[model samples]
Target: MDFETVIGLEVHAQMLTDTKIFCSCSTKFGGTPNSHTCPVCLGMPGVLPVLNKKVVEYAMKMALATNCEINKSCEFARKNYFYPDLPKGYQISQYAYPIAEHGYVLLDVNGEQKKIGITRIHMEEDAGKLIHDEHNPVSYVDLNRTGVPLIEIVSEPDMRSPEEAADYLKRLHEILVYLEICDGNMEEGSFRCDANVSIRPRGQKEFGTRTELKNMNSFRNVQRALEYEIKRQQYLVENGGTVVQETRLWDDAQGATNSMRSKEEAHDYRYFPDPDLVPILVDDAWVEKIKADLPELPLAKRERFVNEYQIPAYDAGVLTADKTLALYYEEVVKLCGKPKVASNWLMGDVMRFLNEDKRSIRECPIKTESLAEMIKLIDEGAISGKMAKEVVEDMYKTGKSPQDIIKEKGLVQITDEGELIKTITSIIEANQAQAAEYRSGKEKVFGFFVGQVMKATKGKANPQLVNELLKKMLAG
Candidate 1:
């Protein structure tokens, strides 16, 4: 029988606070191992854990961004577990009452919109890292990441395909980064995902025994892991073997999943409210303040880009994927008053440079005003579209204006009608046979004449004037 895949992603976004969630240690990514650890995070006796106000505020912003209902009062629980990295031998998390719940994020998959349900968005503390010595075969623990603030966004098992899961993860990542609450760096382990995937008969309502997948650090690997797991489970069922409920690790190099351990049930953690900390109370006034302070979300900004700027939906999606790039597009449009032109350059050249260099839009070499000036030059016919690419590259490399670049390199477009006709006439004389074919009603040879004229002018001749001059010279 044919089967379908079900997936739910549990994402942890490390809050962009200056310090740890329950302690004052630095929340920076790369620090001396165990240097950020303190008595509170080290689980020392007689030390009290103090809550960070910024963590709550950032969590509220994320919860609100995802359309979650905030619980005014919530408490933290002790998730009892033993691990070498978990210094406290238990994790501080939310259980019976979390900060928010019953929310959803909308994803556009293959031109169709789907709302992925968010089961909850809760605050939690991160565990430390365990580094193993490759040569010595000894393991050492690093507690620098201990007590780092994290907001876990759990999704309902509403995804049917790996593509949908990837789309959902991307949308969530965008939202978090756009809110300025999370850096959304997957490689740094700031933003991570644990996928729960299972396959069952296509028409069945009940889900099959699900396996939790971990260690998928990148988005590409997440989708790959899920696809592999689906096929593995399907193969098992077809061979009359039952699928096991367990946690698996995705080996990206091998492109497969290996059983990590038996998946523990919720009760296995044996959660209980922590006595050292008090419950967090978020009043309506506080919630309203955060809501008012929220930035324009991705969906709203995308719609505005299409409706107000008159760009295509695809352009809007690409531009609004990152908040800074979207802002950059608007600044260029304001200066050039050409939305499509701005969208094309931003989505094309701007994105290409940023991706190639592994840089963010904020760190872009070409300033927004510089890009606007280059685009405006194209509009004014000061340079051809082909010339604009060079101008933009110069702007990126030397941080120079388009005017300066054009003046220095003599890259200005040859828009003079007189000069274009002189070149166009010489080209027709060279391609006399094709010109004769054109004069005798072979319209296909028209393109050959145009190509020769552009070649003669070295692509600097104004294309419109070139075409006009070519047709005028060839027809005669």
Candidate 2:
């Protein structure tokens, strides 16, 4: 029988807060292990946890951006568990009443828009990391990540394919980054995903035995792991074998999922309200203020770029994919007042340079205004497009303005018609056969004459001027 895949993502995004979720410990990543811990985060006896107000604000911003309903009253609950990484044994998280619920994020998969339902977005604390020795059978636990503020965004099982799930995750990551709540850095474990995947009969209404896959740190891994899991489940069901409902870990190197343990339910965690932390009361004024402060999300900004700036949808989508890139594009457009040109340069040369150097837009060597100035030079016939590309390479290396480099390197285009004619005349005199070929209806040989002129002038002659002079001179 044909089968269908059902997938839902549980994303845990570490909030961009200065302090831990419930304690005054530092929320910074990549510090000496156990250095960022505090008495409360360490679960010391007689220590009471206090909620960080900034975490609430950050979570509210994300919820408002995702169009979720913020609960007026929510409280923290202790999720009892035992792990070396979790010093508290019971993590402080929201159980009965989460901060936001019933939100939806729109995703475009191959030009078809679909809304993925968000079941809940709750605030929680992150567990520490476990570092295992490669050669020895020993494990080390780093508590630095413990108590770090996290927003667990749980999605409904509405995605049917891995592509949809990947798109949903991308959209949600963009939202989190746009809201300034999360950095969305999967490399540093700032943003991670847990995929719950299952396979059922094509037309069945009920879900099959689902397996939870964790340890997906990147978008590609999420897609690959889901693809592997779906096939694995389908094979099991097809051969009259029972698919177990368990938690699995994605072995990225092996490109497969391994059974970790049985999936835990709410009852298994024995969740209870934390008495130390008071119930959060979000008022209308607070929610409204956060909504007002929300930045223009990726979708709205992309649409605006297409409509207002008259750029293509693909260009707008790419420029608005990252918050910094979008800001940089907008700033360059403001300086040059040419949206399409700016988009071309940004999407082509700027992105190329960034990728080659493994740098982000924020770390770009050339400033937005500098790039605008370079484009302005090319627009006013001060330099040829080819020459401008050379100038851009120099600017990338030396961080100099276009004019400064043009003057210092004497890279200005020779636009004088008289000078170009003299060079073309020299080329025609030297290459008589080619000129005869051009006169005998061999129109393609004109390019040879242009190349000769460019070479004679050491490539300083303006290509447009040469083409114009060559066509006029060769017509006779």
Candidate 3:
């Protein structure tokens, strides 16, 4: 029987707030374990939780960016559970009324645009981390991350393949980063995903027994886990075996899902309204204020890059992928005022150097103004493109300006027409056979003579001037 894979993603994005969701604890990622905790976040007795206003604002920004309708009134609920990592014995989250609902994110899979429906986006608190000692059978729990602000974005089961799921996740991540709500750093667990996957008859209208796959921190892992789950379900169905409905953990090393626990029904959590917190009321003025502060998102910035700067769509897409890279590219363009040249340097030399050094654009040693200066020198015939690349490499290593490098290395182009003519005259007399071939209408020989002249001048000769002088002397 033909089968179709159904997949949905539950993404938990840690909000970029200075404090915890319901307490005044620090929300910083890396610190001494348990250093950022507070009495309220630690779930001590007699402590009441207070909502952070900044968390709500950041959540609102994300909802607006993802085309979700924000609920004017929303309330928090208690999710009762017990785990070693959750000190509260119950997690504070939204149950009945979420902050955002019925949103859609547009994704382009192989040039075909598709809209993935977002079922809901709710605010919640993150659990702490449990570190297991490899040398011994002991576990350690760090409460630093407990009560950190999180937005749980749940998507409908609309994706059919792993690639679609990956595209959806990527587009969602871009939106989150663009909104400045989440850093979207998978390495540090700032953004995580739980994939729900099932397989049913190709034309069936009803859903299959879906299993939730967790522990996917990166897009690659999400796709891989989904693909593995799809095959597992298909094999079970083909053999007339039942696929269990449970929550599974993705073993990345094994490349398969292991059963974690039986899936919990909605009533399992025994969710109730939190009496300590009041219902959130958002007014028109607050929404308008956040809307006005929203920066130009990726799509709008890409369109502007293409229309205003005349860059290719591919280049625009890459330049705007990261907000930091986009800002850097824009600043370079502004300083040099050459869109194509700036794009080339940024994509080629700058990105290459960054990758080689394992650094981000923020850690780059060369400033945008310095890079612009290098490009400007090449544009004005003061240096050759090859020479400019050398100077850029030097700047990348030494953090020096183009003028300083050129002055230090004497790398200026020999644009003097008189000097170029002297070198051209010498090359023509030396390469007598190639010149004879050029005079006999073998046009390719002109390139040979030009190369000889450049080589004789140590590649500092202005290429245009050499070509002009070479053609003039060869004609004679």
**Model 2 quality (TM-score):** 0.94
> Model 1, 280: alpha-carbon shift in Å?
1.5
Residue range 212-295, candidate 3, lDDT tens digits: 999987899999999898988999999989899888999999999999765455437889999989999989899999999999
Overall lDDT per candidate, in order of appearance: 0.91, 0.90, 0.91
Looking at model 2, the pairs that clash are none
Per-residue lDDT, model 1, residue 102, is: 94
Q: Which ranges in model 1 have alpha carbons more than 4 Å from their true place?
A: 134-138, 262-267, 418-459, 469-476
What TM-score should be assigned to candidate 3?
Answer: 0.94
Judge candidate 3 at residue 30 and give its lDDT: 87
Please state the error at residue 421 of candidate 2 in Å: 2.8
Give the lDDT of residue 468 in candidate 2.
83
Model 1 has a clash total of: 0
> What's each prediction's TM-score?
0.92, 0.94, 0.94
Model 3, which residues run further than 4 Å from truth?
133-138, 261-267, 430-434
RMSD of 2: 2.3
In the range 1-476, model 1's lDDT, one tens digit per residue, is 89999999999999999999999999988887788888998988889999999899999998999999999899999999898889888999999999999999998877888899999999999999999899997899999999999999999999989999999999999999999999999999989999999999999999999999999999999999999999999999999999998889999999999997654554488899999889999999999999999999999999998999898999999999989888888888898888998888988887898889888889888888888888888888879998998888888888887888999998888989988887777777777888888889999998887787778777787887777777777779
